[model samples]
Target: MIMPRGSDQLLLPVNPFFIALTLLLAFAFMLLPFGRHPALPDLLAVVLVFWTVHQPRRVGVGLGFCFGLLLDVHQGALLGQHALAYSLLAYAAISAHRRLLWFGVVEQALQIAPLFFAAHLVSLLVGLAAGGMFPGWWMFLAPVIEALAWPLVTIALLAPQRRAPDPDENRPL
Candidate 1:
């Protein structure tokens, strides 16, 4: 039997391609010009929240930070804004990950919603702090959409490793 819950527990192995593909897809989603709302979904943040919960070691602060900075270059946002938000979100994910797995998909989505919101909030906060003009209150709208999108994001993120759960191993309480 697998040992009680811990980092040592057998995690579903997440392939590097999973990470790369998700990030690339997320980048593309962001790069596509927005409609008329002046709001863009937090695609990278959604992916980070997913991996952080499902596979903390595979998706982490450095990855989040780099992705954020890369986003900065791609989207023409401030250089460090996304980097800080992503790193913070990663740290939060690792710390809360153990508790999150116990919750149902809906519950987990509720939990990560704020992390998604906060990551973007931090980005906006940093932008304002850095002398960038404050985006409209509508900028906050993306998080709401992001939170609603979490379930799909989780499925998309985990689809790469969708083997049935190990029958022999104990399920979480």
Candidate 2:
């Protein structure tokens, strides 16, 4: 027998409150003591990409811009550096959302790697233009770390919505 189309939907709704809370948690994680690590992963960017891919309408470039602005203020970086980078990142994610959604999480992670790199590259270029010292070759590490973390993040965020498989498929829940 075929499963009902409605059953394919996640059991839990994607609540905006949870999304906001997750973003706040990611921001706090970013603030944790990394102690001058040049290659720290941007948890905020990862969270942004996660939400953008899963809920494009609710979490788009505007949210990215706001979060990036917050990050800039927190980091004391030249204003608009992260805003520009995250806006670009959101644009890239929005552009690829359809295709990315069709793929498995691992493939999505692979596909998203370049977008993460582009965001970092934009930030680096902006920082350099503003007379900031080069952060070093290790700066490329963040994207790699982010990409690797993508599947794990997806699973974690989505786990609550996943329904348990019916033990008796012959019966409907």
User: What ranges in model 2 sit over 4 Å off?
Assistant: 4-11, 164-173
| Candidate 2 lDDT, 29-137, residue by residue in tens | 9778777577989989999999998889999999999988988998889999999999999999999999998888899999999999999999999999999999899
Range of the 10 consecutive residues with the lowest summed lDDT in candidate 1: 2-11
For each candidate, the alpha-carbon lDDT, in order, equals: 0.79, 0.89
Model 1 ranges with Cα > 4 A deviation: 1-12, 35-38, 164-173
| TM-score (C-alpha, index-matched) for candidate 2 | 0.89
Checking candidate 1 for backbone clashes, the offending pairs are: none
lDDT of 1 at 75: 76
C-alpha positional error of residue 164 in candidate 1 after TM-score superposition, expressed in Å = 5.5
Tell me how candidate 2 scores on lDDT: 0.89
Error of 1 at 9 (Å): 16
